[model samples]
Target chain A: MAALAPLSTYALRLGDDALILGQRLSEWCGHAPTIEVDLSLANLALDLIGQATHFLGVAGDADKLAFHRDALDFSNCLLVEQPNGDFAQTMARQFLFSTFQELHLHALASSKDERFAAIAAKAVKEVAYHRQLSSDWVVRLGDGTEESRARMTAGLDWMWRFVDELFQMDELEAKLAKGGAGVDKSELRAEWDRRVDAVLAEATLARPASRRPVLGGRRGHHTEHLGPLLSQMQFLQRAYPGAVW
Target chain B: MQDWPLWEVFIRAKGGLSHRHAGSVHAADAKMALEHARDTYTRRMEGVSLWVIPSAQIISSDPADAGPLFEPAEDKIYRHPTFYSIPDHIKHI
Candidate 1:
């Protein structure tokens, strides 16, 4: 097979996004509002982490890629890795990102590259469930009570800036998309907007006014939040190199 | 912080099968309850179908009445199919 440097990078970027978000969600293991929610978050974390393993395995040595990479070396979008501010904030981030990911992976599932397509086919199913869970939570929180509605609105506003970055395309992605080995993220925007807007309408929440999109996680320029998240996630591997249980 | 109501979950593991009780979850409504039940009980694709009903809506006989409600049947050996002996020649029985 011919070398596909760009596709590998794309896979890593997707893997890192899932990995970072999985780490963030796992933080809610024992801390979620109820035992059922605790299990739900943990289960979703496991699904994302499982996707990370598959994508990272395709990119390189899965464990090394996950544990050795610094924040600067990661290619995850900025939407993930944001701190879990509250349940509402977490759900907002989950809703936005999972919806985007579901669409993204659904498109990727038809890639000309068989391996990539197979991985995406599997991931899209998981992301579908994640989208449903997050969408349901968004509606519940948005329409539940005065305090929940306020918090849900605030959460959406807080995370709104990062939404646009999910659909941004660079030269590599464009080239791969032309070759049928990648998704044209730009094309996904209209449908993403429709789905999100429908959910928001049902939730009785208005979309936040458009703002300048935050960018650069694809280039490894990340928020201050990513550094600390990496510190904890990489702690064990860094502390004891080659250690295994 | 919001203490949602309890819901009992049931899952049909395959087609043409009954949905047996799996477990329960606490959720704000039936939809969230179904989601929670799916996440909690069907992570392994254990079910082809799911049902989540509010625990509050189910009425049950008190366990304290178990002695009167069930003990009378215990002494009735004729209720047991095993009480009838098969003849030695009845091979298919």
Candidate 2:
């Protein structure tokens, strides 16, 4: 065997991001500000879950990877778990995450591995929709009323610090990039910034200055938020493993 | 306070198609009606478009009047294709 390329650590990381965001989005299933938006978010959540399944299923299956993994094993960054603050904050987190994911998945679509490329190609379309959905909301909520604008900017301010964790590619990512299984996230920064800046401008929000970079999530550390999220999501599944109704 | 009115949902599966009646939901206004329709009915990618109208505005006829409104058209041969000569060019029909 050619060692199977160490199970594509980068794919695992991407899967973590999708799986977590899917779980997060599922939180809005019934309580969205409007019912149309509720359905829209649910559809997007399903898409993310589907994409996560595609990536996590590459090695085996997503169910096993998602519910079976412990705290230290997850590779998702901290930003996704920061809770849905307000409408604007939710959109801001989504806008930033989807913008980042759009470029990442686009470049991954060209991967030398056919399976990876196919997954990325399919996922890019879904993420494009996600980015558009979030961008639209960001503009509306950011420019809506005085209170809403303040909340939107405040949400973005709180969320911006976690963004540095997203682009911190390390040795595993470097190996995967060299092997053509993943993109060098470093090469995608300029495009990411341009897209983000344009959306922010349209939203009439400013980016917060960062004093330092954040990078603990890929190494198994996350904010206090993810634990509670996982507990709720995994509770029934964990309690009734292999027990089907 | 009175509750919101009930609205029936009709959905178009795709463009250039008819909107078939799907179901009903309760909403405070037309916008809320549409929003509730989307959430309750279209979450599964079930329809490409939707129409939500209050049930009271549907102007449905009584079941007793069905015979008068619909039964007369049943045996109208002029309305049917039974009078038309079969042409070979109209193969599918």
Candidate 3:
């Protein structure tokens, strides 16, 4: 196997995260509880897909990288690939992930590597809106009626274990950070915690207890959910290579 | 399952322009109402700004009294700016 550059891997990791989460959000296209909610979700999905395209484009041919990669070769974090359990669950995943992503991109916008910096600069604004959408939902569901509160809590529970993995820095990330091409994830945790905690407080929701961190998605190990997601997402390209609409 | 209140959405296509009624959406609160308005109305870049007012709060004149409300104004040509011609040199009047 040809060894991939650390920077390329980093770009792919972020790209895959956006692509997978966008795919998950796309599942809500026709199924969201309300037409407004459906439009919001779809818009957010489009934003993520746009981000994915830019990130993957920087790494290589965006379409080929997205459609042809095997599941084992993808670098998205496990948190993004988790099934959208319910509205609350989906919101929880989105809130947690977008919060982290926004913070990370803010730091990456100042990266020494101009390419990473440029991409991150553009993505930061889009992720800001995404973060707002998720955060609002989190507050609403958390402070809402008994059923919504319970569902929101359960959703947080479903996602909390994966939170730690987002801040875990492997050698590649550490090297990139040292070279100013990547963010030091550890530095982002405190701010992420502050923003999340404040929102949870306002929503009258308690933070979930910490558990064993589920790691390895950055290293290509993912939950079973990703296989089916990739199959559905990549179907057109796989079935009809080079076909253009 | 609870239905939210309806909000009337207005959009200003550009800066320094009055907001015109665009559409309406249902939301539980003011913030959500604004969000829904943006999601629903601004997808095509139709406006630079938005206003969301609760539909119930707006009092409209009775359409049955249309003649009394507007018919008299229809013939008030003197009130029309177009009644006077501006000098060509007064450009953009």
Q: What is the lDDT of candidate 3?
A: 0.92
Each prediction's TM-score against the native?
0.95, 0.78, 0.96
Candidate 3 residue pairs in backbone clash: none
Ranking by DockQ: 1, 3, 2
Q: Which pairs, if any, clash in model 2?
A: none
Residue B1 in model 2: shift from native, Å? 19
Residues A58-154 of candidate 2 have per-residue lDDT tens digits of: 8566787788777667879888887987777888899889999999999999999888899999999889978877887677668677988898888
Residue-by-residue lDDT tens digits, candidate 1, A81-103: 88899999999999999999999
The residue-by-residue lDDT of candidate 3 on A1-245, one tens digit each, is 25678888899989999999999999999999888889999998998999999889888888999999889888899999999999999999999999999999999999998988998899898889888988999999999999999999999999999999999998999999998899899999999999999999988999999898899898889989999999999999999999898
User: Global lDDT of each model?
Assistant: 0.92, 0.82, 0.92
Q: In model 1, where do residues sit more than 4 Å from their true spots?
A: A1-4, B85-93
Candidate 1 clashing pairs, residues 3+ apart or interchain? none
Alpha carbon deviation, residue A181, candidate 2 (Å) = 1.3
Clashes of each: 0, 0, 0
Top candidate (TM-score): 3
